[model samples]
Each structure stands twice: as structure tokens, then as C-alpha cells.
Target chain A: MSAFWIATIGTSVIAFVLKYSGHSVPERWLSHPKIQRINALIPIALLSALVAVQSFSEKSQLMIDQRLVGLSVAMIALFLKAPFPLVVLSAAVSSAAVYHWL
Target chain B: MAFGAAAVANGFSVLQACLLSLLTFSGASQFAVVGVIGAGGSSISAIATASLLGTRNALYGVIMAPRLNVRGFKRVVAAQVTIDESTGVALGQEQRGIDAVKKGFWYTGIGVFVFWNLFTLAGALGAQAMGDIRAFGLDSAVPAAFLGLVWPRLTGKFERILAVSCALFAIAMTPILPAGLPIIATAFIAIVIGMKR
Candidate 1:
């Protein structure tokens, strides 16, 4: 068995706990408007932190490449409500093409 | 799921396929980790990258927690569903003022989880029969996933920063940093920045 499986499955149980444990608590404890607003913001912050990293960071030192161009186009496509597969597929095609030619 | 199939086709085992889905449970991370490990990268690197990919779930959980209000056995089920799509659906339903959004979370969670896990096996097996997964653009899958996630959250400049800052930083830093770590680093930085503000 590859190590990835060992890690993934084991983590799945742990991740499951982390994800679900929050809900079992009493609603009054969590339902406060302030808590609600904060609960709402937490994901936004976490997601922002996440996407920021994925879009730009590569193993190398701050290199912006064809992927960025593809990303911008993809974002635009998303803004246009182009649908899931299309946005990604178009970005991949354009990035690959851009890399091949430019 | 598709990634798992690809892994098996490319020489992974059934256990490997399932573990990747159950544990790593992320296509881009799984593929990258497997590719790196297959190519002789260190275990540390593979695990680190996989964990980084999984961090997005932290976002899903934080967002879904309120709506789910789930408890006990159902909480167990709901947690399994706390990925990008299910979370989005639940949040969207709430925005539309749908009642029982918590139920929607459960439904989407179970539905996507079952299909996604099954597809992991499919992808693993498919990879065995097919030569490669290029037709799927698995690498390109991450940003699309992010877009689906980030689009619904964008409401202001604050959110724009919250959403785009880490990605932009990661892009700026990816060329210099190690693979997968930059994203994690950006999240940490954002958290630190957010906490301070």
C-alpha cells in the first residue's frame, strides 16, 4: 500500500470529526448572532487564505507563468456564468496553448 | 474518484485507490502527491502537499457549521459532506432563504461523497485501461473548484482581499517556495493578518 492511502484514509476519519463535531453542540451556544456572523466569516477567511495560495504558489520562487493568464480568463468565464467544466477546460486549453506558443 | 482510478491504472493498489479518496480525498492533491511520490519525492513532501490541499475543507467546515446545526450520528454524516460543492449548495440554499438547509447539506454531502468516492475508484480503474488522464485536466481542476467556492463569497474589497490575497501571494511566491507549502503559508499569513485586524 502506498503511503498516500495510509495518510488519506486515516485523515478522513479525523477530518470527519473536525468537520462534524461543531454541529452536535447546542444551538443556543452557537446560534448567537455574533457567533453566526463570526462563523460566517471564518470560512471566508479560510477560503481566501486557501485560494490565494493555490492560484499563485508553485515550488519555485514567485514565478508567474501561463497558469496566471489561464486563471484570469477562467475567472472571467466564471463571471460570465459559463459553467464548471467549460471554465476549467477553457483555462487549460488556453494555458497550454499560451505555454506552447508564447 | 477519477484520480483514484488513475492511480490504480498507473500502478496503485485497491487500498491505495480507496485511501487516496478517503484520506487525501482531493484530486489535485492526490495526483500531485502520487506523481511526486512515484517519481521518488520524499514522504514529507507528499504528506505536506496533501495536507495543504485538504485545508480548503477547513473553510467548508467553518461555513457549513452554522447551517448544518447537525448533531450526534447525523453530525457524523454531515461532516463527511463538508466539501466545496455541498457547502456551496447549503450556503446557496440559505441565501435563497430555503428552510431545512441543514437537510440540504446532508443530502448534498451524502450524494456528492458517494459519487465522488465511487468516481475515485472509477478514475483509478480507468487510468489502468487508458494511457493517461490528460483528457480530464485534473491539474486544472483546482482553480475551477476555487472559483466555485470563492465566487459566492465575494461581497466587498475586504472579501476580495480575503479571497484573492493568498492566491495572489501564492502565485507570487510559488516560484520560490516548495510545492504545496506556499498555499498553507498564505493561509497562515492571512489568518495572522485577519486575527490582528
Candidate 2:
């Protein structure tokens, strides 16, 4: 199978397993303060890393271009507490303009 | 819906994106899968990052299982839909009593599932029709979406700093490591801080 298929199916199965495990496992096992604290931070770390990777890097190389403007606009929109859709829309619009015009 | 478009923009087939929504159903993990693979990361990297992002669902399941109290086929179905929205709604209805909780869980869970899948299909089809997503700046939309997802979670100053630091750390690691590994490496920072406190 292709890498995409493998990742898709494999990740899905694992995600289901993680969900099911929570249902079946004893509450105390997962309720530990340390565990919960770590779990909460995991997404924060992964997502921030994703933002960096997506905005700054292009494949194996780091390239700065229109995406940076898009991300900056996103940050400003986020700071202004614009709705999620608006944030994405503003970023896309600004980035596209930069890509085409500059 | 954005996921559908983003997935296609990231090089996934419409069927693949739909399957992700149907099966995985977790937004962050699904996006991570597409993003990692699109960036030429290995399947292992994609799965690892996605699975790590999905750990919260298990926590949500733990909170919901007792409140739900189902059996056999129903239990399996309940597990599938045990997401943030369902659990949050179920908990929010706590003052109303058990019936409200159950109703909240089922209604919200199934509702999100149906709409989320439908929108995924729509977004995928729309993005597919767009042809050359880069021209439309959808490439930046992917990261912007990630930022949106994480934005609400940064509720405190420390969390905000940690997130920014992690972003920089990943960027610093980018030149040295492969595509997805930098993201994985940031988990250690969380672990260390988590251990310290």
C-alpha cells in the first residue's frame, strides 16, 4: 500500500485504540495529576511545532516567503480574537496577495 | 470541511480524507497525519505524531464512559463518539440530571460526527475543484488552522511561552532532522516541564 494509506489507516486504528482504552481502563490509571498534566501539554507542544514546520520549512529546507506574512496576519487576527474562520481567511487572503503581487 | 480541503491540498485523495474523518474523527490528529505526509515525512512519523495528538480523546473517554454507561454494541458506538464536544456537553448538563447528560452526549456526539463527515466531503470536493491550492493561499491556511487549534489552549502565560519555545525549537531542529521528527522532539520539552511540576 501507499504511504498515505498506511498512515491514514494506521493512525485511525491507533486513535480508536487510544479512545477505547480510556473507556476500558480504570479511571485512576489515567487520572494521575502528572499524567493529565503531561497529556494536556502534548498537544500544545506538537501544534506549535507544526506551526513552525508548516510556516517556515519547505520540505528539507527552511524557506521564508509568503507563508510568513500569512502566519503574521493569522497571529494578529488571533490577537484581535477574530473568529477561527476569519483568522484562516485573512491569512489566506494576505498570503495569496503576497504570492501573486510580490 | 477545512480538513477536507487541507488534506487534498496536502496531496491526499478525496477518499483518503473522507476515510480519515470517518475513522479517525479527531481533527488535530487527522491534520497532523496529512501535514506530516505532505511534507515528505515517513508514515511512522505521521502515525506517531497523530497518535500523540490523539491521547486526549482517551482522557475524554475516561470521563464519559461512566456517565454514558452503555453495553455491548452501544458501548462500542459510545467509544467511537467520545470526543471533546460530546464530553463537554454531557458535563455541562450536569445540573439537569442523568437523562440530560446522556442526551447531551448522544445528541452532540452524533451531531458532530454527521456534520463533520459531511463537511469533510464538501471541503474535499471544493478544494479538489479549486485546482492548484497554492494560488489560493490554502497552503498558509494549513498552518493557520494549526495555530487556531492551539490558540485557545494557550490559556496561561507559561503555556504561551512554552508553545512559542516549542515552535522555535522545532524550527531550529528542522535543518538537522527530517520533516516530522522536530515536532516529535518537542514532546520531550513538555515531558520535562511536566515532570518538574
Candidate 3:
């Protein structure tokens, strides 16, 4: 009835189509050189953009705050090859500290 | 992260958040939906932005299809849980042989589906009780988890450069673009560089 419901249902349908179509398409097309390259790189680009936006932006404006501090800490933990949950915990703890102290 | 945001920022109900996780099963796209709605964007914009971000899962599907041959109803189940965690775990188990790969995919996919839904409900309820999500710094977990996901993949010089450039490109576009569009725009960078290489 509402736009929110419609959007939710629409997103689900779109996701299903995308996933099922992956099986339906000829295997050759999915493995094209260009497609493979794009596939390899898209995750990196998408995840990096997610990190940047989540860290620095507030709504539509570019603002920095505790999130940046959290990200910085998480980046270091990641660089050290820490466990995944530990990296997340380090970031959350650092962010909580920033929120409390700064 | 997203379920928490949906609860605190958008004032979404527990049902709404859980249904979203169940149906979409995409962390990024679900977050984009809430971000778009929280920013007062139209539903069209919300769905469009979410779909654009989800296009990558389709790519994942392509990569996983040959690796996971299925038929009939099993295809539907596989399609539902074909997410980053499942695909990543599946590929990581490639060395152990085909059985291991299948086990990895099913275990991760089912595990994430179950846990993600359960935790979404928990996060929604927690946000409802806490009243303010900022103090806990749960908001930052979205990006932090993303960073955790992407970092291990960037083992080489070129991947590192591409990832850094894309992060900069996304940040630079934040002020100019709408809430969810900046993330979507990063795909162009990958496309261009992917073409060049």
C-alpha cells in the first residue's frame, strides 16, 4: 500500500531476477574477459565507497566525526591482519571512545 | 548496522526491518534503502539506488553459477543466499575440493541468513530500547564491517590503488550527489579501469 512496502517488494524482485538470471545466462557470456575483470574489481570499488560514505558523510553533506576515528582504528587492525570480529570490535570500541571523549 | 539505522534513524518497525533482511538479503542495498528514505528521498529513488548497488550480486551469481550446478527448486534456495559471505567462503574452500566448496557455500549461506535475520530483530529491539544509537557508536559498524570485508581482498598493489582511488572518488562526490548515488558512482571507476586493463 505504502511506498516503503512497494520499494521493499521491488527490491526483492530485482534481486531474485538478478540471481536467477545468472543461472539462466549462457556460461560463456558470464565468463567474458571484460565481465571477469569488472567482476573482480566491482567488489573493491563498492566496498571502498561504502567505507568512505559511512565514515565521512552525514546524510548528503560531507562531514567527519567519530566514524573517521573508528575507521582509522579498524584500518590499522585490518593492516595487522587481525581477526574479523576483533577488527569490528576495535572499530566499535574506538568509535564509542570518540563519541564519549571527543 | 543497517537494521540499527533503520530502527533509530528511520523509525522502522521490527517487522519492517526483519522483512527487509529476509527479502533483500543484501546488507548494502538494505542500508541504501534506509539511507534514501531517512534522507527524505522518494521511494523510486530508494528502489533505484538499492537495485543499482545490488547489481554486483548478479555478477557474483555469474561467478558462482559454474561452481554451483543446481536444478529445479534447489536453484531457488541457492539464489536466495548467494551473498558476499557465501561466495567468499565457497571460493576460499576451493582448494579442499568440490565437496568442501559446496559445504562452505551452504554453511555460510544458511548461517548468515539465520544469523542476519535474528540479529536484525535484536538490533531493532535494542535500538528501540536504547533511544539513542550514537552513544554506542553502532553507526560506525557499517563502514567498519565493510572495511573488514574488503581489506583482506586487497592483497596486491593494483587492488590497493583501485580501492583507495574509489574511496576518494566516493568521498569527493558525497557533497554533490544524493545520499545513495555516490556509492553507485564508484562502479564507473571500476568499469573504466577494468576496460583499460
Candidate 4:
């Protein structure tokens, strides 16, 4: 199978296992304060990393371009508590303008 | 829909994107998969990052399991829909009693499932028709989506600081490490801080 297919299918299976395990496992195992705290932080860390990587990097090279504008606009929209779709749309619109015009 | 467009922009087939929504059903993890693979990362890296993001669903499962009290196939179905929205809606109906909780869970879970899948298909098809996705700035939309996901979760000073630090740390590591490794590495920072507290 192609790498994309492998990643797509592999991720789906792992995601299911994770969700199913939650229903089957004893509450105490995952409910510990430390474990909960770590679980909460995991997304925050990963998502933040994602934003940085997607915005500033281009395949192991740090390059700045239109994406930085997109990200900054996203942050501003987020600050104003714009709905999710609007925040994303504004960023895309702004960034696309930069990509085409500049 | 954003996922559909983003997945297409990231080189996934419409079928692949729809499959992800149908099976995985977790927004952040699904996004992580496309983001990692799109950036030229290996499948293993994509799976790891997606799984890490998925750990919370297990916690949601724990919260919903007893309340749901299902068995056999019903239990399986419950587990599949045990996401943040379902659990939150279920919990929010606490004062309304058990019947309301069950109703809330089912309605919200199934509702989101149907709409999310349909929109994903729509987004995928739409993106495919758009031809040059970069012209629409869909590439930037992916990161913006990530920002939107994490934005509401940063509810405190410590969390805000840690998230910013992790972002900076990942960017710093991006030049030195491979595509997905930098994101995975930031998990250690969170683990360390989480363990310290």
C-alpha cells in the first residue's frame, strides 16, 4: 500500500483502539490526576507544534512566507473570539491574497 | 469540511478523507495525520502524533462508559461515539437527570457523526474541484485550523505559556529534526511539566 494509505488506515485503527480502550478500561487507570494533567497537555503541545511547523517551516527548512500572515490573522481572529470557520476563512483569504499578490 | 479540503490539499484522496472521518472521527487526530503525512513525514510519525492526540478520547470513554451502561454491540457503538461533544453534552445535562443525559449523548453523538462525515465529503469534493489549492490558501487553513483547536483549550496562564513555549520549541527543532519529530518531541516537554506538577 502507498504511504498515505498506510498512514490513513493506521491512524484510524489506532484512534479506534484508543477510544475503545477508554470504554473498557477501569476509570482509575486513566483518571489519576497526573495522567489527566498529562492527557490535557498532550493536545496543547501537539497542536502548538503543528501551528509552528505548518506556518514557518518548509520540509526541514525554516522559511517565512504567506503562511506567517495567515497564522497571525488566525491569532487575531481567535482573540476576537471569531467562530472557528470564520477564523480559518479569514486566515486563508488573507494568506491567499499574499500568496498571489506578493 | 475544512478537514476535507485540508486533506485534499495535503494529497489525500476524497475516499481517504471520508474514511478518516467515518472511522477515526476525532478532529484533532485526523488533522494530525494529514498534517504529518503532508509534510513528508513517515507513516509511523503520523500514527504516533495522531494517537497521542487521541488519548483524551479514552478518558472521555471512561467518563461515559458507566453512564452509558451498554454491552456487546451497543457498547461498541457507544465507544465509537464517545467523543468530546457527546461527553460534554451528556455531562451538561446532569441536572436534567439520567434520561436527559442519555438523550443528550445519543443525539449529539449521532448528529455530529452524520454532519461531520457529510461535510467532510463536501469539503473533499470541493477542494478537488478547486484545482490549485494553494491559490485558495487552503495550505494556510490547515495551520489555522490547528490554532483554532488549541486556542480554547489554553484556559490558564500556565497552559498559555506552555503552549507558546512548545510552539517555539517545535519551530526551533524543525530546522534540526525531521518533519514530524519536532512535534513529537514537544510532548516530552508537556510530560515533564505535567509530571512536575
Give the runs in model 2 whose Cα sits over 4 Å from its true position: none
DockQ of each: 0.32, 0.82, 0.61, 0.87
- lDDT accuracy of residue A67 in candidate 4: 92
lDDT of 3 by residue, B1-197 (tens): 44554435465667778788998888777876665565545677677766766776777777777788987798888888888889999999999999899899989999999998988887778767766556777767667877887787798999999899888998898788766677767777888888999
Worst ten in a row by lDDT for model 3 chain B: B1-10
Put down candidate 4 lDDT per residue, B1-197, tens digits, no spaces: 89999999999999999999999999999999999998888889999999999989999999898888888898888888878889999999999999999999999999999999999999999999999887898989999999999999999999999999999999998888888999999888889999999
What alpha-carbon RMSD in Å does predicted model 4 have with respect to the real structure? 1.0
Model 1 segments more than 4 A misplaced: A1-3, A26-58, A61-66, A96-102, B1-75, B82-103, B124-137, B175-177
Ranking of all candidate structures by their TM-score, best first: 4, 2, 3, 1
| CAPRI grade, predicted model 4 | high
Error of 2 at B61 (Å): 0.6
What is the Å distance of residue B161 in model 4 from its true position?
0.7
The TM-scores that each candidate's chain B achieves against the reference are 0.63, 0.96, 0.81, 0.98
A98, model 1: CA deviation in Å? 4.8
Error of 2 at B29 (Å): 0.2
lDDT of 2 at B57: 94
Best by DockQ: 4
Q: Model 2's CAPRI class?
A: high
What is candidate 2's local distance difference test score?
0.92
Instruction: Report the CA-based lDDT of candidate 4 relative to the real structure.
Output: 0.92
Candidate 3, residue B127: lDDT: 69
Worst 10 contiguous positions by lDDT, candidate 4 chain B: B75-84
TM-score of each: 0.66, 0.96, 0.86, 0.98
Worst 10 residues of 1 chain B by lDDT: B132-141
